[model samples]
Target: MTGLAGIVAAETRLSMVDGENGRLIYQGYLAKDLALNYSFEEVAYLLLYGKLPSKTELHGFQCKLAENRHLPAYLIRILNELPEDMEVMSVLRTAISSLGRSEFGWKPNIDQAIRLIAITPVIVAYRYRQQHNLPIIKPSDNLNHTANYLYMLTGEVPKDVHIRALTVYMILTMEHGMNASTFAARVVTSTHSDLASAIVGAIGAMKGPLHGGAPTEVIQLLDEIGSLENAELYIRGKLERGELLMGFGHRVYKTTDPRAEALRSITSELIGEDAWLDLAYHVEKTAIQLLDEFKPGRRLYTNVEFYAAAVLKAVEMPAELFTPTFTVSRTVGWTAHVIEQADNNKIFRPQSEYVGEIPS
Candidate 1:
């Protein structure tokens, strides 16, 4: 199949993407359910360990994560040595690969998974700071993952609204059925590669604009629109020009993405009665109307990136950090799938169709 669309590569017990019905399920629970009830650490535990953690289990898990949050001095030195213009994803990939603390024979273990999830935010924040010539703030052992991410991003304690909005976004994005990056992670892991190598490859795949990089573009789209009054005209003009609206469509979901719905609600709650939220909603309404009018019968509803832009903006996250933050949240999902793949080892060797003229 072209782009391997609709091909079931592997059976997973982790998460399901019901594209037709617009639902995302993680371990038999609706994604929204988990987002509302679970903390990022708790969600990480569920995905990595296959069940929600008990109170004590959760405490221990949190401590373990906290313990692993700090990067080694050598890695920090390497972060300091990165070129000022180096992309965040490249920095993250290099740092994660540098985190290969063991030999290639290392199996997929919870310790490896926890270490990956824990260090991702630190790497992102540290690299971002160094790129901008800001001092690297150490990770906090006291705050939870979401809070700590924001805290490190800005060297101050995060506001509750920022914490909650980002937490929900993290939960919703934690896992879904084999997206490009997750597939990349699983594919690397299938070869019995070390967890860090698999994760590094996944980070590389996620840096692509077609995959994890769209959220930042969504922000650029809105900033270009500038005002609600310009939204309809700007959108209609783009549609008439056959331009791709950055956040309007999805490859899998025919209906409104549940993650987008969750993010819209979360943004509303976090930035109540704000100009940004008002503009985003106006843009959404206008764009949906224009799309329905311009492209008939092809229902292009709002996907996660649409409101993910708003939510990240609401939390004052820089545009460049959009995909890296995604990498941070998705590390759990990647490692979980990696562990699962390792448990049931199978080398992913798909045959490609020879398109060009082959020598007979």
Candidate 2:
């Protein structure tokens, strides 16, 4: 009976997502502050090693991350052959599954982790180009994770703020305790599966509308509303039908999501001068007011999806690539968690209540 939902053990190393206070903290530091003040390399070091890296350690880590940025030709060919009409997430899933078939597929060593981190941006960039019939841009050794991803995707270096926003988004989405995708990863790792398989499983879970698919829907809702004047009508109509606003609530966060605000300010900074900034701000204000006036006691504040979509939209990344880009950044966390689970190896079976009658 005690094993029904097997304890994943007293929470080991991780930042707390403080729902009530609207804060996300890594080793006790706030996420919004981290995104503003730290580089992605620094944040990645903190997540993987449980402490901030020294200057030399960070440089070395960044080098290793950059080293794996080059994808094998075979992988790129496979990606190019995928149907252009396929959804980008589908393409990512297929590509990772393909990697699972490679020689180093199931290895859990440092090499495997580096490879996953390095090539994720490549898969994302190549698929994006293939979808658009544009030439694939290669990764550069000089650039860090955030910079390289932007370069490969757009064939140019991003503005400092844009890069910083993306780096924050990556860190924010990196790891959360037992999120659907993270849980899926644990289940796969329980089988001593390869990194690619574990990632594929996580991607499958994230494909669900309740999880990774919300950002795309959030963007769609904004476009449908078209202007600030219609924000109230749009959100009210959706809520009246008993529909949950796409980016407003979380299953775990009882009060607010801290990552939302972190990304919210980033969205504003990135959208500087685009008229859409004003439109989105008005929408945010209207959404808050309506949620307060209507839902009264509910603490449905913005989650990461709200500003994530806005920020990415401001960067001109297509709506379809939101989740795929999410996958790329989050792959680091998935790999880190899988390694952690395998190091303390345990099967992740959970039993459900037997509600049905016994068979004769």
Candidate 3:
């Protein structure tokens, strides 16, 4: 028998990633179903509590998220000092890693979750503004997490479609169990590292091409193709050279990524009549056709990356901010997973098959 990589954990109820079939289920519900009906707050509660929250519970959750929107003064000062040209993710990585030093002897459970949640958007927005020489914009307590992030990123109140598109992105990107970043979180937690350390480690992992950063590349692919007329040729040429298409493949989904469908719809609706929508549609169709003709043996289908890039672009978000925006939406899931892991009290230690030279 061949040694197993254990890339697919068959037993854990942690997360379900069905790449061949293109399905992603968190807890028990389908990601597409959640994205269509639930707000970001509702999905966050569902992920954390194992079921959808009732109306009253959801209201309370929204309030809690809104209440925690402000960043601490110290973090603000640190944000101000960061170099203007630094990448947003780099700034976030450093700021979050340093947050551990500020933890006082003790704080209440809710307080800690609140602290993590509140400061996330601030950190994201602060770095973005600093990069452009714009002043930091505080999140409005009256808005939900998704809404407030848009408000902070772009000073105007986003329309309903914009909010919905972003909310769907959040629901889709949230916890995928034992993914590279989640495993990083669990690994750091296993070492008894602080929450901030675990999160910083996770952020670093997510910054990689094979992980959370793929959407930015997907957008770049679209830009290079430039128009629908060029998409098929461009993608086919790349596929011929054995280049990995950024948005089409997944490690776990054997069929189709459900989140892709949800995001595709949101992008279409958000753009309505924009030229990019037609371009994206043509690209999607062309990619499918080319893949069918060229890579018949492989199950490469569009994943969350495709529509995530489209929707972000539709909202006029710069390509550089894509992953940081991902972090803004996913912080809820990260915090929820961290809390869940802390509750279960397991040190995520796994045995490794030794392949290196063994000492006598």
Candidate 4:
């Protein structure tokens, strides 16, 4: 099944990507609705625990996440010894693999999942701060998962709007149906390997540019456009020259991307508050109009990375951290898939077709 397109490899109760209708469902709830109304911890809990947590359950989960946010001394030392110029994703892959002790062995469990989810942002922020020679900011108990990540990166409490925007992005991106990284994670788990090992594999897959690097390109597009005045001209020139627009369309989403829809709503609400988001909202409208005019039957619309570039930029996230941030959110999805794979284990062994003649 060349690249496995149109093949149903396994069953999952996690997320369903309805490309036909441009809808995403997370365990029967619309992902857009969840992103608009729920917290990151709530959605992560939903994915990992198979349901939303009660008030007491949520407090306990939040406490557990806060407790596990600190990096081990050995891991910190490892981070210090690594080269400053190493890619952040490479650093993350190394740090996660370092956690594969005997306790993270076969038969993955929720405790192991929680630990990885909690510490991923710390690993990224630690390495990033060290690379820039900035002081490392420890995680704050007062902040929730989304806000703490922002705090660690900048050492200041983030604005409520920035936190809300980032939380929506995180929840919307937390899961999708069998994406490359998620598939990599599940394949490794199917080998009866530890959850950490499976996640390491997923991180490796995400490290590839094809999967996790779209946001960087989208950022470049936004930077080039620069302001609302230039959006139409810049986008029209690209379309006229038959150049690829970075965030206009998607392979699976035939219409608008639901994730993009939710993010656009948030960005639109903050129109006068953030220049980048305002620019993004305008640029998206211009680009879509130009897309329909230039490539009339293509039906190209803004994908998640379009507004992702805007939101992250509005919150002052550096360009280099884009994919790593994606990794941080996607860890929840990866761990959830790992747990599901363990429940009904099967090694992923697909047959490859050969065109050459066989020996008789």
Candidate number with greatest lDDT: 4
Residue runs of model 3 more than 4 Å from their true location after superposition: 1-4, 7-14, 101-111, 229-246, 350-360
Candidate 3, 1-360: lDDT as tens digits: 343346542234435767656677877888888888888878777776778889998888777777766766887788778777778888889888667875711221444555666677778877787788776677897878788888888887887777887788878887665667777776676566677877788889888866776477788888899987788789989989999787887666777778888887766664545677567777887998899899897877887778788778867777777888877766666666666666656566557778889889
lDDT of 4 by residue, 1-360 (tens): 368988898899999999999999998899999999899999999999889989999999999999999999999999999987898999999999999999798799999999999999999998889899899999998899999999999999999989999999999889988989999999999989999999999999999998987487888898999989999999889988989999889989999999999999998888898888989999999888888888899889999988888899989999889889999999999999999999998899988889899999
> Order of all candidates by TM-score, from best down to worst?
4, 1, 2, 3
Superposing every Cα of model 2 onto the true structure, what RMSD results? 3.4
Q: What is the lDDT of residue 264 in candidate 2?
A: 71
Candidate closer to the true structure by TM-score (higher is better), 2 or 4: 4
lDDT of 4: 0.93
C-alpha displacement of 304 in model 2, angstroms? 2.0
Instruction: Compare the candidates by TM-score and give the number of the best one.
Output: 4
TM-score of each model, paired residue for residue = 0.91, 0.86, 0.86, 0.96
Q: Which residue pairs clash within candidate 2?
A: none
lDDT by candidate, in order shown: 0.87, 0.77, 0.74, 0.93
RMSD of 4: 1.6
Judged by TM-score relative to the true structure, which candidate is superior, 3 or 4? 4
**In what order do the candidates fall by lDDT, top score first?**
4, 1, 2, 3
TM-score of 2: 0.86
Compared with the true structure, what per-residue lDDT tens digits does model 2 show for residues 1-360? 553243544254656655666677776678778777788778767767778889999889888888888888888788878787987778888988888866545546556777787788788888888778788798999888888888898999887766776788887877666677887887898888888899889999888876787477778877888987898899888877887777788766777677777777766665546656557767887888888988998887887777787778767777777878888877877777887787788786666788889989
RMSD (Å) of each candidate, 1 decimal? 2.4, 3.4, 3.3, 1.6
Off by over 4 Å in 4: 355-360
Candidate 2 weakest ten by summed lDDT:
3-12
